[model samples]
Target chain A: MSLDPSFVGRTYPPTAPYQVGREKIREFATAIGATDPAYHDPEAARALGHPDVIAPPTFPVVVTMAASRQIIEDPALGVDYSRVVHGDQRFAYTRPVAAGDELVCVNTIEEVTTRGGHGFLTTRTDVSTAAGEQVVAVWSKIVVRGEA
Target chain B: MELPTQTFRVTRADLVRYAGASGDFNPIHWSDRTATKVGLPGVIAHGMFTMALVGRAVTAWAGAPDAVVDFGVRFTRPVVVPDTDEGTEIEVSAVVKEVTEDGLTRLDVTATCLGEKVLSQARATVRMAR
Candidate 1:
């Protein structure tokens, strides 16, 4: 089923604050083989002007992906999660996310369209500090394959 | 100018670790049965995992962990992972697209697996080291 075009521009409520942990950053960096010292050592990060060990550039996806469940699971929107495949991803950062930052995400449906019998949905997530400081904006596009 | 190329190996173990770290437990990335059921050839690497690998390349090129200001990619193909210890390899290379007056450098990146492009329209902007 095609997504509702009217759902575009619909914004969801902000998610609960997610406290960024140093070890989590380390674990994520390690998982990606991002061995840069700044990702694991507070002193190394401080040398680069960050308050704590900074997350890798794509780290925000961890939070945004979880936050996006609000839209994907919306029965009204009718997203077939089983048929969904990631199509595109983009991130614009206001500042690097560092450990100890309490983050919140505000999700919005950016676009919804149908093409070639497939449903395409785009979602934008604004990530910010719990104190309301803007951190990063994340965008994701997913394609729902038409029934064969 | 072209930057040095970066390469990464992707094994099922890496996918499992990435799934744990990123909180994306999508069975398609680990379970071959689930993947084939989904019409996928076999167990595949997560799109975010491939993006993260490219992100590593971007930061490494910028010479600063916090240098990336913008990054994006289109997932054009799947990096299918065979159940093998050697796994598959992804080769990442980039060219300097522009260097702004304000010290931001833009890069056009390419990532390929098995000699097939897996990402397109891949790019990154970073704060250049002073």
Candidate 2:
């Protein structure tokens, strides 16, 4: 099925608030093999003038993944989840994500195009704190395989 | 161990090798003219590849490459690798910021290109060996 052009500019409800814990930040950093002290040590971050342990920029993926459920599961979109691959990812940040912050995500379908029997879908998630302070915008391109 | 500040002369070859190792082959990484056409100053390195190098620096510092518990970074700016005789060595490094009660290690990371930051507001964590 073709993507719904009408879905362009559609916005999903903000995801449930997620608290950014130092340990979780640490876990994310470690899982990706990062060894930055600022990710877990408040003092180290404070020395750099950060209020707390600062989360790495990619840390927003946790909530972004949850927020994307709305887009991938949209019955109108007709995306085959089984054949999807992560084509690309990027983030534009207004500020670094810090620990101890409560944040949520709002995802918007930016574009949908099909080529060579493949569907290319782009999703942008605007991530921010519950207080509405924007942290970053994550853009992802996913390609779905054609039906055999 | 005292943290080291790194500066690299990254050649196009380095970027290609990185793509091979990381499984990220975004054309923007290898095609110079394509990169210029895309409004980038020049070909830039993948943000994740930069993150991976920084991750390597951190894990090496932690005394175990596989001991890191988590790592992530945001791409604030793109590292425009210039097309020159040599290339670019992404100035990627980390500073030990703190150690938690549970003994997790935290480090603030930064990667720069030609004096401009490519990945900013970055951080990582490593679990120390007992």
Candidate 3:
């Protein structure tokens, strides 16, 4: 099924607040095998002028993808997950994510198209704090295989 | 196990195995012909695969994978995997950047591919076990 081109530029409701805990950061770091002290030591992070432990830049993907489900799972959107593969992902940041920040994400369908017999869905998720502090913008592309 | 930093020679074979494991068969990653068509010297490794490796490196330090909360990086330059004489061994290094009262720590990272900065201005946060 073809994605709705009209969905392009459509923005979804903000995600529920996700508390940025220190342990969560560490788990993610561990999962990726990061060993930098700043990822676990406040003094190390403070030496760098940050308020607290800063999360790795790519950390937002956890929440970003969660928020994207609003659109990807929309029955009307026609995106078949089993047939989809990651195409691309990019991140632009205003500042590093710090612990203790209660963040929210707003997902937007940036573009929809068909290429090489695949359905392409591009999305942009803007992440920020509930207090409205801009964190980062994540852009991702997924390709759904042609119907069997 | 005490977390030990790894420094290995990044070979074309290493990159291919990574692509296979990650399910990223992007032509630019393993096909020199495709890379040349796109103006790269040879194959270019997937940015995410590198990121994955970096993540694994950090997580290994923490001794638990699920403890990481967030991680991100910028692709400063492509890590062109040269086929001749084998590929270059890329070096990845990270230092503590910041720590919060909540016991979360952020890391400043640098990854060099063939003596050139491939991933820069990287950051990650990890929560310690309480």
The two-chain DockQ for each candidate, comma-separated, is: 0.96, 0.06, 0.08
Query: What residue runs in model 2 are displaced by over 4 Å at the alpha carbon?
Result: B1-130
Cα displacement (angstroms), candidate 3, residue A18, comes to 1.0
Model 1, residue A1: distance off in Å is 2.6
Tens-digit per-residue lDDT, A18-127, candidate 2 = 88788777766654445668776889878766788876555666667667878898887888775665565666666667887888899888888878888888888988
Give each model a TM-score: 0.99, 0.56, 0.59
Ranking by DockQ: 1, 3, 2
Q: What is the lDDT of residue B54 in candidate 2?
A: 69
Give per-residue lDDT, candidate 2, residue B120. 56
**Residue A25 lDDT in model 2?**
73
The TM-score of the first chain in every model comes to 0.98, 0.93, 0.95
lDDT of each: 0.95, 0.71, 0.72
Model 1 chain B: worst 10 consecutive residues (lDDT sum): B58-67
- For each candidate, give the TM-score of chain B: 0.98, 0.84, 0.83
| Candidate 1: stretches off by over 4 Å | none
Superior by DockQ: candidate 1 or candidate 2: 1
Cα RMSD for predicted model 2: 12.4
